[model samples]
Target: MSTSSPMRTVLVANRGEIAVRIIRSCRELGLRTVAVYSDADAGAPHVRMADEAVRIGPAPARSSYLDVDALLGAAKASGADTVHPGYGLLSEDAGFAEAVGAAGLTFVGPSPEVIARMGDKVAARAVADGCGVPLPPGTGTLTAGQAAEAAAGIGFPLVVKASFGGGGRGMRVVGSPAELDEAMAAAGREAGAAFGRSEVHLERYLQRPRHVEVQVLGDGHGTVVHLGDRDCSVQRRHQKLIEEAPAPGLTPELRSALSEAAVTLARTVGYVGAGTVEFLVLPGTSEFFFLEMNTRLQVEHGVTELVTGLDLVALQLRIAAGEPLPFTQDEVRISGHAIQARIAAEDPWADFRPAPGTVSTLELPLGPGIRNDFGLAAGGAVAPEYDSMFGKVLAHGADRDSARRRLVAALGELRVEGVPTTAPYLRTVLSSASFTEARHDTGSLERDWTPDPADRPGAPSGTAETVETPTVSSGTIRRVRIATDRGPVEVAVLGRAPRSGASASPSRRPGRESAAPGASGPGGAGAPPIAPMDATVVAVRVEPGQEIAAGEVVAVLEAMKMEMEIRSEVAGRVAEVLAVPGGPIAAGSPLISLT
Candidate 1:
């Protein structure tokens, strides 16, 4: 094993909760930490928690967090001997890792070669195949034409996956051959934007498969060990929302097989540091197929920590410092069950739309077996230019049921105002029978889950319903319902009074616009399509005089690194196009006019 100089100061190359988590671990190890932030995150909790901070660039990730030169510059200026990449951004970028090594700064992960090999879905498939590991039917990297040709052989109901990155950014599930082309295009665009590589591959879509992964740690000295398993089947749009350790309902033999396969794969590659070998398992069967390997720490690593009582981050630092494994596979012990719920700034009632705003109130649940890893605080901003997730709530217990109950209670106690959150929806999921029974799979959330009526904005009791009153010459008064522990109460809010004989204009907030008289807006006759949120217009699919049908996509908007297709609700002729590609547009802003 190659030896490196001892590290003292570490620079974190990411933002939000993961950054804060890494800094805390470093502090415990008596190491100084340097935090890098964009303009939007200057006041973020992670910045305050670090020993020192450096502003990298503007709010956009491409200009800041993902900028290699800026990150390395920060490391140099801060005199950090080590760089710890937290989860997303450029965490798994092989080029970034190589650059850090070239700059003589230790990267707290595996080798760049192993990262590049496993980060590519196609190449990892070959390694798995060589290791005699089971794999789903899929094709190698392909162009548009090759993808179409392979789609026919793979049949319908396949997934288009980005070859270079994970976290469900560059992935699309096509139900038929008709959707293959668009799926591939979208997946490629997203993959390119997120991972800096557009290469994609195809895989046969499984029916309600369980998403399971084995966590592996390796020392460059040829020692590798598996840290049990985790079930992340509860997902939406291929993104994991909930994760639990000691994946339930796995037969002993099947569990052994998964561990052996993962350890073998990691050892074969001479892997170092922490990594996860993901798999897709057919429910109620021993059959499993290799998914992709995340060459860095996972977002749900907290659950594994809760069960195994090990700090994966500290281990990564030790491995990077040329330390050997402190324990063998036999010495590792898994105890109890643990569950984690991701708290994101999204509106579950609106299909989990990203809802970024200032946090007016922040209250996290605190109690036994509950841990809250949060990045934002009261008065902090949730920037639209980054990922929506800002915090995670984890609960550990003696059993799965106990853990589930604790998480449910924790979420119930959680509160965040000013921005919509997924806490309520997550609570519902934890309390759902599908989850409690371990019957939910990767597709279950999209297939069977529905937003609780009480949780909707304008639902009946226990909801934040809006009641409009008669308009006066000044303006209109709206009563907003607020649910408290006592009961629901209506609070009258006064709007800005308009000028004499003038009508009120819509508020500039996203998704809160009031359609103007004879002006196009959502659900208005001859109204133009409006942007659903604050985003950059990626494409304007429609032009003036173009006839379109209801539900036809007129534009594509990119926000928080996710693409949203803006569809028209009423069929009409396009009168005007207000959105320009690559331009910023506010929520509720019209994208196109219809006549």
Candidate 2:
């Protein structure tokens, strides 16, 4: 267990950017690495970086990333002695941790009991209270009358939260008697959807609870230490957008207290490896309340690593090997500052709707302090089946001010084409006054922000052009060409654009061409068929050996929480079903080849 002894081979049990991160750390530590991938991630950056790789399952997380038996089988087959489950997916699943340990492979995290205790928000609160940590005023599970009475005791403006969810999924603020039931029901529904539980608890909601979290590392030898704090208040829809270490605007006394609280919580849990203990710091008071503990590495752990100059993954591997605490409390140091922006594949203008597609071109930022944890290359598809995050851009400097300025500048020059992304929107946030000075909270995004009209893509600055309309859909598409001063061009309304007064017109358009039964149609046998928008295939209804009728749905796709039926274009026997449910196939991936 000594630091001098080394590990030979380790398997990264997850995919995407974090897997690549662990692989790099293993390389630095003189350890061979294995990468696991789903069908959708076969060509990902992490797979290419690893020394070896094995396919876990199909694209869906249940079959792939969260498949514990397959992952253990792989470690046994590959002769891997250790397995590292990065954040999300199976990282916090206590059963998965126990399985890895039972298989005699080191699970690079806390013990299974610790994972279980922390994974359950209700029990975690009990432990924190037992350890003398301050919890916001709240009540246990109660019926309608009891909930109302408890809310009265906790005062108005309290939050109802599900006992099993984190990252603010099952939490809702209720301020009045009329809204308590509705709010509680909504919170419970969200909890049930997110964590498979409808049980919820209530707590007093702090209006300006600054999102502050302490990073800590522990080992089985009963040693724990704090590595400073990060500010994660910049958020939208309860998701963090920007994170920075050495949280801006912290006094010496508060910082010390936060660090001590984090270390105390770890000691209470007998924790190990890298974990984050988050707190909701009330803005104008010294009273901070426990939010929840993340039992695995965090998405923003990179900022902490940048400032502390420690490879956290290496420490995790070392601890799992039963090494004694590497350093004393005083040995940890906080230096400089680091800022990270989550580059999401969402449309900022459309309520941050997930926009997933292929990347035609990508010009990511590059410089001394700019770091990109990207998972995609040019032409890689960002399918709608998974999370809408492409990656994060991390920048560090001598201080907070320098780091902020550099991150803003770097994002300005970065470009991602093809799919709609928040790259332009993030640049605007970086340059805004509130973000520049770090003078904001989680609600500031909804408060002081506005969409920049100029960031939207449209026409060029100076151009003399005939705007050609798009002709789309393999069905009847109407297009007409109109002559202008510039030249002759087409303006076809690819598919049917919605019109007013019930149902307006049919395959007839204004500018270019129209299939008016006799008029000429666009090239392509018929009109080149287009998938109805973008969506993930949830079920394929047709099989190769079965026949489909004209109106029958060949596949079902889900997008924006709506199920879309993909109907057959031609009535014939299905020759092939090119895509499977839960697989991330492109828009044109043939669902059924009809004869």
Best by TM-score: 1
lDDT of each: 0.83, 0.72
State in Å the error of residue 282, model 2.
2.1
Q: Candidate 2: how many backbone clashes?
A: 14
lDDT of 2 at 6: 49
Highest lDDT: give the candidate number: 1
For model 2, the stretches where C-alpha displacement exceeds 4 angstroms are 1-6, 141-155, 175-198, 457-494, 497-595
User: TM-score for all predictions?
Assistant: 0.91, 0.78
- Native-vs-model 1 lDDT? 0.83
